[model samples]
Target: MAGLSAMEKKLAEYKCNTNEAIQLKLVRFPEDLEDDSTTFNPEYSHQVFGDDEVAFGFKGLKILLYYNAGNLSTLFRIEYTSKVNENFDCVEADDVESKIRKIIPPGFCTSTDDFVSLLEKEVNFKPFGTLLHTYSVHNEEAGEDITYQIYQADMTCPGFRDYHERLQTFLMWFIETASFIDVDDERWNYFLVFEKYNKDGATLFATVGYMTVYNYYVYPDKTRPRVSQMLILPPFQGEGHGAQLFETVHRYYMSSPTVLDITAEDPSDNYVKLRDFVLVKLCQDLHCFLPEKLMQGFSQEMLTEAQQKLKINKQHTRRVYEILRLRATDMGDPEQSKGYRLDVKKRLIGPYKKKQRELAKMRRCLRPEELTNQLNQIDLNMQHEQLEESFQQLVSDYRRVLERLAQA
Candidate 1:
């Protein structure tokens, strides 16, 4: 999590890049971020890119570069500068930062570390690293709950200098999280959630998704508590307990003034899907309407793209599930329910977007008839599976009828 200065240095010095091909050329600034340059008014933020060379345009300075490695899209928050001065100063013809500074959203962290640093600085509490492991065993004879071992960290313990087990650290995080429920100052971002099982008074769950917040000034001044790998145990997977933990964590972030900026890298398909379910679906459940100013601050186009992806995934997932249920009917075993759910999740969470989004925009939007046709196709597909099962049942009945006829 470096800063703009470090990114700029990398852009200036790097040679051949990895991933996708690179292209570069100067571009006209998008309307949302432009001011008087090229005298063009547009509805949206426009961007210009090249195969080996990528150009990020702004009001004063623009970044023009060739990548040394990786796909161009894989590059995120890559350090490049066109301008940096608050004043419209351009004494240095090629001073990188001064030119592109306008393109970056205000208070956006240049690197993950920079964002975490902000979290540390804003809060007075000790930083606990992560949750490790946990398990529970039913003690039928003892008539009491038996937790095997839980690892946690207590970074804030008085005179407790030993960094010791990861368990201790995680416990500190859990207890502190509970304590912050009473806190009302503007410091806590969201009650960062972590899992811990207290067995013989030790923690097992290790902190996983190391995260931080950038006070958003997000929709309605609520902070989004982004999370990562923290888990309870296999036994807790679908019990809905995760939601309770999440509620506590988010309640802190949603307090009056704390805003959250959850930045992810070029995310995996599963990561993208999870974020959609939480940020979009669940947010909708919460009536997550942001003020125009705050909402405008977000990447509307990106979210639009995300919503589309989620719809496709959900459709495909339903298809797979329909197939599985048909098979289960033929097999006549309820045992397959567990496996079917797991497979459905994998497909639903996997990344599958591949069309050139810019060009896809050119495709005429679906008409009412076309929309109806698509639904008909899905229904037809599902109907075929259902019919197969019906046919099997028919065959079984015919056999029984034949036997009765023979007896007659």
Candidate 2:
């Protein structure tokens, strides 16, 4: 038993955290090759590594996946101080390289010298689509305004489909549950953002990030465009690129008469905050959401105007209304704060109220034994506690939205 315990301790030394081991870089210049500032780590590795996101039987592992910022031509390399192999006999190292190969597409350069050579071709690589909007953001580090352009592209565009395959690879590292979409589907719409820069007296564009929307057919004629994926690469995040990208996409859909509404597929918490900020900013300018109307409470007028003008659906409009309403509410006044809390709680209680109605009907129709089982599932006192908890959480989220809105 003592020997076995000693062997286990020896094996534990071989483990490496995959998240730290994986290093990504978007190389724009030769100097960036040696710059640590250009490197960013993946937010997640569980999808590539195991759920624990650890690689077994490797000591001091570093997986470098670097790409040309303009064309995203990749260079893949792995370095390790020690790896468990036949010498261990009782243990084997994880097949780290093979797992990474499955995510990165074919035709990637494995040689550093060869990869550096590919950067020369980036000067000729231009963004592939019609430019929809152009804007500049102040880069604090650079101390100058950097221009970015958002473009609308599809599979039909020449070379875009191939470029997108390379682009989507970043999603795996950044998004927790990211998956590639079927570019073969004609209904998919792609919105890409690129940084337009002047390189060697010639203009060049570098990939910032992208979004994919799937237009699902709504009953008779309209289509509901659901945002399937949105990713602003790690390097470009916290600079307001996401808000610009989201607003641009939302406005693009708002102009289309056939678009029923805009929605998102399982939005992350960060995405929700982005959406709220954008929606509130958009609605703030609308007459229906003016302070006078907002103070009157959420109305059918607000819903209709938002849906008709902005292509925002009912549920989203209601949430936006509550956020805007909270902004207009005077929290220091006891009467005003109570009204705001009760109004939000009423919306929060909707699901429970629905279940209660179902329970009442079940009491009338279900067998006594069935009703007893159903009654056991719900406790009114517990629900009241839950309702209060939900209301508090929602108010907290609303305040955050208001805070961001104030900054905007």
Candidate 3:
């Protein structure tokens, strides 16, 4: 983002996968409302920050996307309301895609391909800039597959059932290394678990965890890929599998032909040690320097404390979101719903007004809408620490814009 020109920034998008759009529709998550009349409108949902990989919709309705990991790329899963009598393969996937579009907002994407292309255009922000859509698989530079089998991906979508056990096996292996490497579907991002299949029938070996990237709204595509998680099975530990997997993933990026800018969080010494070992030492071995950025008011000590506080706040906010989502779901009971809506309004209003004052005091120049967004973010994360994080991201972005512009 800092390296991009002011002009190039406008055309930049953080949304990856221009190969083809895989759009699905459903109701909004107790999230901001969607055009309910639209089919396949999985645009709305009712999930909290760290909840199940849930997709809420009728049978067959979903939001879908295709992603490439190494040499493998596949159309991924989506959670939705369903009662499929037969196995997933027994169902026609395209028919399900069609049905979802009819039920959610936008009345079903006119064409999945067309809609995805446009969505990529709109969601053009990322925290860091990397050539996202250009992922390639190179066996020449890739690592030898590890000798472990995985169970499942731990998601509750229909089509993935057959592969569930292996996905779970993979996760079990992952938990052996890192306690938290499961998917966070609400964000449409995941920590990948790579695997290998045996010669005859069973699973063989697996790579522990994969790092995911998110669009932090600070980059051109309104997104950035951050190393959100890591993993390595206990049995596979000390044998250097972690280093092998790390090297494999890093090698893919090294071959990116362009510097792949990435970031990760490591409040614990073990992780910092791992990052230094894999990201820095190894990248330097590749003749590349791991660029460093020091954030104000954030350090190893603060990060661990922040992690605990985030869990608490996330649960609290999840309840609020859930209640609001229930109100949206049970519209049949408006009188009962009114109280919840009013409470949300009351909870949100005061903060925006307060944020308006805070921003007014801090910076002389701000657009009304931008200020409103900042205030609303502050309102959303009302707790002290949450609000501070919200502010750090927001103000840092504001400062970056000025800095980038000055450099230009």
My TM-score estimates for the predictions, one after another, are 0.24, 0.95, 0.27
Candidate 3 Cα outliers beyond 4 Å, as residue runs: 1-215, 251-260, 285-408
Clashes of 3: 67
Ranking by TM-score: 2, 3, 1
Task: List the lowest-lDDT window of 10 residues for candidate 2.
Answer: 83-92
What is the per-residue lDDT of model 3 for residues 99-169, given as tens digits with 9 covering 90 to 100? Answer: 33332223223343543443333222111212222122223334543333212222454433233222232
The alpha-carbon lDDT assigned to residue 92 of candidate 1 equals: 26
Best candidate (score: TM-score): 2
The per-residue C-alpha lDDT of model 2 at residue 329 equals 88
Order of candidate numbers by lDDT, starting with the best = 2, 3, 1
- Candidate 1 clash figure, as a count: 60
User: Which residue runs does candidate 2 get wrong by more than 4 Å?
Assistant: 362-377
Reference-based TM-score, model 3:
0.27
**For each candidate, C-alpha RMSD in Å?**
21.8, 1.9, 23.4
- Model 1 Cα lDDT, one tens digit per residue, 1-408: 578688665444432221111112111112212232322111111221213322222232322221111111111143333333332343222323432333322333454344334332322223243323233444556666543222222335342223222112222212212111112224323222323333234333322222222332447655443343333322233433333343333433334344333333344443333333333322322221233322222234334432333222333233322332333332344555444434444443342222224224434676767656555544545654654565455334433433332342
- In model 3, the Cα lDDT at residue 224 comes to 28
Tens digit per residue, CA lDDT, model 2, 1-408:
999899889889889998899999999888898999889999898899978999998888999999999889999999888887734885779888899988888889999889989999999898888889999998887889999999999888888877888899888888899988888899999999999888789888899999999999998999999999999988888899999999999999999999989999999999999999999999988999988888778899988999999999999999999999888889999998898888888888899999999999999999999999998888899999999998888889989988887886
